[model samples]
Target: MESLANLECFVRSAETGSFSAAARLLALTPAAVSRNVAMLERNLGVRLFQRSTRKLSLTETGEHFLASIGGNLHALQAAIGAVTTERGEPAGVLRVSLSPSFGIGQILPLMPQWLARYPLIRPDWQFENRPVDLIAEGFDAAIGGGFALTPGVVSRTLAPAHLIAVASPAYLAGRPLPRQPEDLAGLDNIVLRASRTGRVRQTVLRNAAGLESAVQLNESMIFNDPVAMREAALLGLGVALLVVPDALPWLERGELVRLLPDWYVDLGVISLYYPSRTLMPAKTRAFIDFITEHFEREALARRFRAGPG
Candidate 1:
């Protein structure tokens, strides 16, 4: 508990950039904050902050230590809250970030029941194609693909990020059908350019037999957002390689047809990401458990696994 107090003081000092500011935030005296930090430095045998007349800032070691233990401090606080509260009925605004199509198509549908189950929990969600800084943005959780596992962030696999080629029947009316992976060259293609890299990415398609082949589309059209790319394909513009979960509704209704039915690309895993805390907030933990259980009950992960149908 003493060590925990020292850590809490250090984290607060690091965040606010001074012992006085940390003292104000933690409701302690500036001298006490300084003493706690000094004790921590002695125990760890490393100077955490470089002190100056104008300001104080974390040393290189201090920066790394903060990144590593920041989440655990939060978890410790949350655990204390969980046990201390009288009812502890998970009351809070549950802020989440996720992709548009999947959030709308898959996650959005699950919300009504979830809300009913935990009415005290208010939903605050953002839908985007690109990743956001989960901690900096003050998000409780995020769901998507290709997010770097930075310090204090953890993820649980929700579903496979599988990409399959699709086009409206009108677009392929007179165009050559893609019988093989290479046959996509003969058809009009809608490419997805990485917003960060500004490069049209290549996709590796795999079949049931475990054979893999990479395909590069000749860009008849390019889109930065996955939802827009799928919409373009649905508008009869061209064949677009889209994640299966995003296209499931359209595919099920016969509005979009899968080109090369036996082939799909392994983009990665669609995951639920949250802070890697020693103990999570009740609201965040509840949401995580609910979503995980829902995914299992529906077998959505198995349905979305990469490769042949």
Candidate 2:
């Protein structure tokens, strides 16, 4: 039988697409991860990956193998969790991955309460804009926007957020305010590089006639951070699109004016995602419940609602 260690190595390597990354996550060298995967392949009598200088692709046999064993692996983990829960208190390291903005706005504020409630459970947090591989990265949970939950991980919606376009009143004072979506084609824009996917930021704008046009923005003063972009927009640099939760305060204070009130992009729900709860560690379960309860409370929920424009 293949060893559990080798099986884990295979899964990690597959999920990360890099031997070096998987090695770092597992606290081992790349050569060690490669060896474990090789041993597993030998035991199974089939190659699992096609490797090149630039990329790693799974073999057909490897895909089938993963599909066949994935459920069993999760079940084994769940069994171990059940035993641990029955014995005593839950105490272990829980890793969480989240975007920097959400981390700053939501999760960080409530972390102290979580720490006080579960003093025995330690947490490792990583904040970034990139997509994370939960299983390969060894993360217990992640908070993020959008609905693109990867296969094998489960996701639960925590809240809803919308994207809005805004600019400073001084910037719009002399310039002809856009009456139609196409009018923005020639205007200066403050684009966020971190939020752009591929070559453009996909935006939908509504004209006075209530007609919506899908605009692909490729030109702008691009910034890597949202806060910086919003600051620049506040200084009359240009129009910018930001999430309602992040831009509402500026709008209420009259530092920024909503450019297009009738049109906005629905970024869908912000969610807390994790591996199956059947095998979830006690610390992770507690944190998830705490966050869910916090958002459900009337006072806290009101704080998230879009304020006066």
Candidate 3:
């Protein structure tokens, strides 16, 4: 068990590239994680990490050992979780990745109730707008849309991750509304720089009747996050494209109005993504089931429909 502890510390540190990051994931102090890995090095009579101020890199032995054991770590965790939760109650840290706009606006609100219901499971969620390498980064689950489902990972649809052009009433006080996708070429677009690629992503607009068109938007301002884009539109800076879920509140409050009521960018469904079902940890499984049920009960997916946009 002591060897197991050391291996866990070493593996997490390797995956995260630094002791501090591993500590956050493990819910331990950086010093404690560093000490554990050092102890393991002493026991094995070899340095596992080549440490420097900027980052931690794996030594040869560390790389070999990690390759040998990393694949089995989940199985070991699942076995322990099975015993710890033999009574059918899920317990353990449940780490998840989420985008801030939806995480803060929608999911965060339901967390109190979720925590109450699953008192044993600890939520360690990361709020970010970029795509995450779930298996490599050791995230239990992630939420978003348009991510390619790699082998050994799976997803469950939550709601449409559709995008539509919007502008504040003040911004469009006298401006002609865009009646078609191509009309958007004439409006000033607040665009998003893709987090993963560092490029402006192409927007494909779809109509209610399923017709599609691409737009080469005229950029007025550019943002890296959806929240910022939403704010720009709200401030009457320019027309911005936003996901339905993120823009729902503003639409309801009449702070922003959707343009081209029939056109939307089908970015695909936002989903709860996780590792394979086989050998899944109890905490993750519990979260998946809980979130699914919550969505159904609240009819949350329908709310993302947001009256055409």
Global CA lDDT of candidate 3, please?
Answer: 0.81
> Top lDDT: which candidate number?
1
lDDT of 3 by residue, 101-204 (tens): 98888889889888897888889999988777665456788987766676456889988777878899999998988777888888889999998889998988
Over 132-197, each residue of candidate 2 has an lDDT whose tens digit, in order, gives 766545577898865356544688877655667889999999788776566666678888764536
Considering summed lDDT, which 10 consecutive residues are worst modelled in model 1?
Answer: 79-88
lDDT of 1 by residue, 119-170 (tens): 8888999988789767545578999988877655788998888889999999
TM-score, each model? 0.75, 0.66, 0.73
lDDT-wise, the better of 1 and 2 is 1
TM-score quality measure for candidate 3: 0.73
Every candidate's lDDT: 0.82, 0.72, 0.81
Candidate 2 residue-wise lDDT at 36: 80
* Model 1: residues with Cα > 4 Å off, grouped in runs: 1-87
Over 4 Å off in model 3, which ranges? 1-78, 83-88, 306-309
Judged by TM-score relative to the true structure, which candidate is superior, 2 or 3? 3
Worst 10 residues of 3 by lDDT: 77-86
| Candidate 1 local distance difference test against the native | 0.82
